[model samples]
Target: MKILHLDKNHPLLFEQLSQLGFQNDEDYTSSKEEVEAKINNYEGIVIRSRFDIDKTFLDAAKNLKFIARVGAGLESIDVEYAESKNITLIAAPEGNRNAVGEHALGMLLLLFNNLKQADSELKQGLWNREANRGTELDGKTVGIIGYGNMGKAFAKKLRGFEVEVLCYDIKENVGDQNAKQVTLEELQEKTDVLSLHIPWTEATDKMVNASFISKFKKPFWLLNTARGKCVVTTDLVQALKSGKILGAGLDVLEYEKGSFESLFTGNDLPEALQELMKMDNVLLSPHIAGWTVESKEKLAQVIVDKIKQLYGFGDDEKKILPPKEYGVSGLGGFFFKTKDPDHIKAWYKEHLGMNTDQYGWTFWWKDKEGNDCSTQWSPFKEDTNYFAPSEKPYMMNLRVKDLHKLLNQLKEEGVTVVGEVEEFSYGKFGWILDPEGNKLELWEPNDRAFL
Candidate 1:
C-alpha cells in the first residue's frame, strides 16, 4: 500500500514500514493546498499536527484507508468526517503518557515549594527564606479531570505521596486503586489542587471560565498539562488576581497558535497573557509536557506498530488455536452496572482505544484457521433489571457451539434456565444460572452478521 508522511519522524517508522513492503514518501514543506491536490494518490497518511485536516481535505483523499497521528490528540483533524468516509484514525497517547505525567508532577512540586521564586532570589544573593516559605503536598486533596491515559498516568505518579487522589471523569468505573472516581461537584468541593487532563473540543473549549473557578469551595493550585484552549486566559488571570487560584503551573497557553510550534510574534500578545507573564506565582513552559527524549522514539514506534497491526502485517507470529470440542469455548461478553452507559462508552474510546457505540465495544478476534469471531463488552445502567433474580453486579456471556443442543443438555442436567432461547441477527442467545445463582448468557455467534 502507498503511504505519505506529512512530517518527519524517527527513521524506524520509515524503515519498518518499508521492510514490510509498503511504499513510503515524504512531503514536509508543501502547503496544505499543494498537498491536497495530490492526496488521492496514497492510501495512508501520517501526520503530527502540521496543519488542519478539514472536510475539504477529507473530500480530496478518496483513497485514504487510515490517518496516523504521532501525538496524543487528534484536535487538528476532522475526526467525525473522516471516520464517516471509512477512514481509520489512529493516535499514540500511550507513547507519551508517562512523560506528561512526570512533567505535571514536576510542575506541581515547583508550585507547592515556590522553587522558581526561591531559586531566582538565591541567585541574586538574597537570604530571605521567610518570603519563600512553602506549604507541603502531604495533606492536600488532588483532583484530576479526564480519567484517560494522561490522567491515569498522573495519578499513578502521585501514588507515593500522602495525598488523596480523586478523579472526575464523564465516565463511570474509571476509578482505580490510585484514584477514587468522584462526581465533579464533590471534586470541586474537597480539592486543594486541581489538574486538567482533558482535550480541546466544542464542549471543553474555554470550559474552565470564571464560573468554573468560582465553583471551587476553597482556593486551589492549578496545573494544566492538557490543551491550552480548555481554559480561558482572561478568566485564569482574573482568578489569580482575586486569590481564587493560589498559583498556576501551565505547560500550555490559550494564546498559542494552532500549530503549537510558536506564539504571537513581536508585542502582539493579548493583555491577559502579558499580565500572566508578570505574575510571580505562575510558571509557564513551551508546551513540552509530552515531548521527552524517550517519548520521541516511543511515539514513532507506537505509530509504526499500530499501522502495521491494522494491516495485519504485525511481527507477532504466535498462532491461535481454536477449541476442538465446545460445551463453552470461551467468554463471549462481560456486561456490568454503570451510572451512565453513553459516557462510559466515550471514555473507553478516548482512553483505552476501543471503538465503541451505544451497545459498547464489539471485540473481534480470530478463531483457528484464521476465521473471524466476535464478542461484546458493555455497561448497563445501574437501575436496569438486566441482571435480575440474582441481583448480581455483572453477567457473563459464554460462547457455545450449538445454542439449542446446549439448552437441551443444560435442561437434562437439571440446571435452572431463565427465559426461552432467542435468536437475533448476530447470534442465538440463551440464559441460565450457575449453582451460586449468578446469571449467565450463552451465545452461538454469527460474526459476519454484525460486521
Candidate 2:
C-alpha cells in the first residue's frame, strides 16, 4: 500500500513505516490543488494540521482507506465527510497524554510556588525567598473536568502528590478507583484547584464563565491545558480582578494564532486580556503543553501502530491493541439506548422540537431556523449487548446549524439547557438533557470545523 506523508521531516516515522514494508513518499508542503491532484494514488494519508482534509480532498482520494493524524486533535480533518466515504480516521492522543499532563502539572506548580517571581528577583540581584513562599499540594483537593486519556494521565500524576482528586464528566459513573466522582457543584465547593482536560465542544467552550466562577465558594487555582476557548477569557479576567480565583495557569489563550511574543506585546490586545497579562498570579504558555521532544517521536510511533492495527499488518509481532470492545469503524455516529424511549423521545420533541414516530423506532428534529437535525437510535437491549458495561444513559451530539436560536428556543420551551450559547476558536454549541436524564449536544461548525 502506498502512504503519503503530508508534513515531511519526521525521520522516525519514515524509518518505522519503511520497516513495515509500506511504500512511503514525502511531501514537505503541498498546495490544496496539488494534494488533491495526486490523492488518488495513495491508500493512506498521514498528516499534521498543515493541510485541510475536506470534502474536495476526500472526493479525490479514490484509493484512500485510512487517514492517520500524527497528533491528537482531529480538528483539521473533515472526520464526518471522511467517515461517510468509508475512510478510517486515527489519532495518537496516547503518545502526548503524558507530556500534556506533565506540562499542566508543571505550570500549576510554578504558578503556586511563585517560581517566576523568584527567577525575576534573582536575575535582578535581589533575594525575597520568604515573600515568594510556595503552596503545598500534599493536602489539596483537585477537580479534573474531563476523564478521557489526558484526564487519566493527569490523575495518575496527581496520585504521586497525595492530593484528593475529584472528577466530573458528562459521561456518567467514570469511577476511577484512584479518584472520587463528584458533581460540578461539589467540585467547585471543595476543590483547591480545578484543571480542565476536555475537548473543544459546544458544552465546553466558554464553560468557565461568570456564573461558573462565581459559584466557587473558595478562591481556587485554575488550570486549562485543553483548548484555549474552553475558559471565557473576559470572565476569567473579571474573576482575577476581583480575586475570586486564587490564580490561573493557562497553556492556551482565547485567541492564539500569531507568534506568542508578538501577541503579548504592549496594548494591542483585548482590554480584559491586557489586564490579565499584567497579573503576576496568572501564568501563560504558547499552547505548547504537549509539544515535548520525546512526545513528537512517540506520537509518530503511536500513529504507525494504529495504521498497522487497522490493516492487521503484523499479527505475530506484539502491538498495542485498541480498546477491546470499541474497534475502529466508520463514524456512522454512536449508538445510544434509553430505558423510557417514549418519554425520552417525547421530551426531545416537545422541548427541543424533535420529531418522533408512533412506534418510537426513529426520531428527528429541526432547529429553530428549520434545518434538519441529525438523529439516530437503536433498541436498549441491543445496544447493551453491543456496548456492555458502558450501557448507561449519556449524551449524543447532533450536528446543528444555528446554535443560538436553538438554545433560546429550548429556554422558551422550559428546557434548562445547561449552558449559554458561546462561540469558540473551534465551533459554536450548547447543551440540554432529556427527561430520562440523557445529555444532548448541538454544534455549529467554524473554521477548522472538521475536528
Candidate 3:
C-alpha cells in the first residue's frame, strides 16, 4: 500500500516501511491545499502536527486507511471524525517517556537546589552560599496528574528519591506500583510538589488555575512537562506572587506558537508571561523534555513497530487488513434450555409451523446482497453447561458482516465483548454481556461453505 509522509520525521520510518514493500511518498513542505489535493493518492499518512486533520481533510483523503503520528499528542487531529470513517490511528508516546521523566526530575532538582542561580553567581566570582540554601526531595509528598505513559515514567524515575508519590488520573484503575492512587482533593491536600503529565484535551485545558491552586493545603512547587495550556499562566503568576505557589518548573507554556517552532519575542509577550520571565523562582524550557536525541530515534522505531503489528506485516498478507463493512444483518440462531427438550421441540413443531428435524428447526432466509442464510432453533437440557461462565438460560446469535470489526466497534461504544472469537465449521461466534447481565452471542456465518 502507498503511504504519505507529510511532516518531517526520522529517516528510519520511511526506510522500514520501504523494506516492508510499502510505497513511500515524502512531501514535508506541502501546503494544506497541496496535501488535500494529493491525499487520495495514498492509503496512509504519517504526521507530527504539521496541519489539522479535520473533517475536511478526512473527507478529501477518500483512500486513506490509517494515520500514524510520530508523537503522543493528538490535539491537532480530528480523532472522532477519523474514527467515524474507520481510519486507524497510531501514536508513539512510549518512545519519549523516559526522556520526559528524566527531564522533569532534572528540572525539579535544579529548582530545589537553586542550581541555576548558584552556577551563575559562581561564574561571576560571587560566592553567596548562605542565600542559596537548597531543599531536600526526601520525605516530600509529590502529586502526579494523568497517570498514563508519561506520568508512570515520572513516578518510575522517582523510585530512589524517597518521596511519597500520589497519583490522580481521570481514568479509573490507573494506579501502579510507583504511586498510591488517590482522589484529586486528596492529592491537593497532601502534596508539596505537583506535576502535570496529561495531554492537551478539552477537559485538561487550563485545569490548573486560581481555583485549582486554592484547593491545595500546602504551598507547593509546580512542574508541567505535559501540555502548556493545562495551567493558566496568569493564575500561576498570581499564585507565585501571593506566596501560595513556592515555585514552578515549566517545559511548556500556554502562549506557545502554533507549531511549537519559535521562541517568543519579548515585545510580543503577554503581561503575565513578561513578569514570569523576570522571576528567579520560575524555571522554563522550550518544551524539549521529550525531544532528546535518543527519543527521536525511539519515536520512529516505535511507530514502525506499531504499524507492522497492526497490518500483521510478514505474518500473512491476506490477514493484513480487516473487512471494511462491519454491520449486523440478521439473527443467526436462537437457543434456550428447557426441562424437557422433547416437549419444547414438539410444542414448536405443532404451534409454530417449524418442520423439526433430528438436530432441530432451520429457517432459511436471504440477505440484502441476496446471499442464502439460515437461522437455527434448538432447545438444550436445563442442566447443560454450554454457557459455562454465564448462568443465563438462553443464548441468541446475531449474524454480522465482519466479526473483528463489529467487536472493535462494540468495544469503542463501551459494550464489553467477552472472550475470543470462536471459529467453527458453521461460523465464527463471539459473546457479550448486556447491562442487564444477559450473555448475547454474535455470529458471522460461513454460508458459502454450508451451501
Question: Who wins the lDDT comparison?
Answer: 1
Candidate 1 per-residue lDDT, tens place, 1-451, comes to: 9999999888888998899899999999999999999999999999998899999999999999999999999999999999999999999999999999999999999988889899988999988789999989998899999999999999999988999999998888999999999999999999999999999999899999999999999999999999999999999999999999999999998878778888755667799999989988999999999999899889999998888778876364633444335467667889999999999999989999999987889888885557766778999999989787768999998888777887888899899999988898878888999999999998887763322
Model 2: ten consecutive residues of lowest lDDT = 324-333
Per-residue accuracy of model 3 over 291-332 as CA lDDT, tens digit each: 999999999998998899888864443443433467666666
Q: Candidate 1's C-alpha lDDT?
A: 0.91
Q: Give the Cα error of residue 158 in candidate 1, in Å.
A: 0.1
In candidate 3, which residue ranges exceed 4 Å CA deviation? 263-267, 314-451
* lDDT-best of 1 and 2: 1
- Go through the candidates in order and give the C-alpha RMSD of each one to the true structure: 14.9, 21.4, 13.6
**TM-score comparison, 1 vs 3, better candidate:** 1
Kindly provide the TM-score of model 2 when superposed on the true structure, using C-alpha atoms. Answer: 0.66
* Candidate 2, superposed: residue stretches over 4 Å from native: 258-267, 315-451
Give residue 179's error in model 2 in angstroms.
1.7
Which pairs clash (backbone N, Cα, C closer than 3 Å) in model 2? 74-451, 75-451
Candidates' C-alpha lDDT: 0.91, 0.77, 0.88
What ranking emerges by lDDT with the best candidate at the front?
1, 3, 2
Estimate the TM-score of every prediction. 0.72, 0.66, 0.70
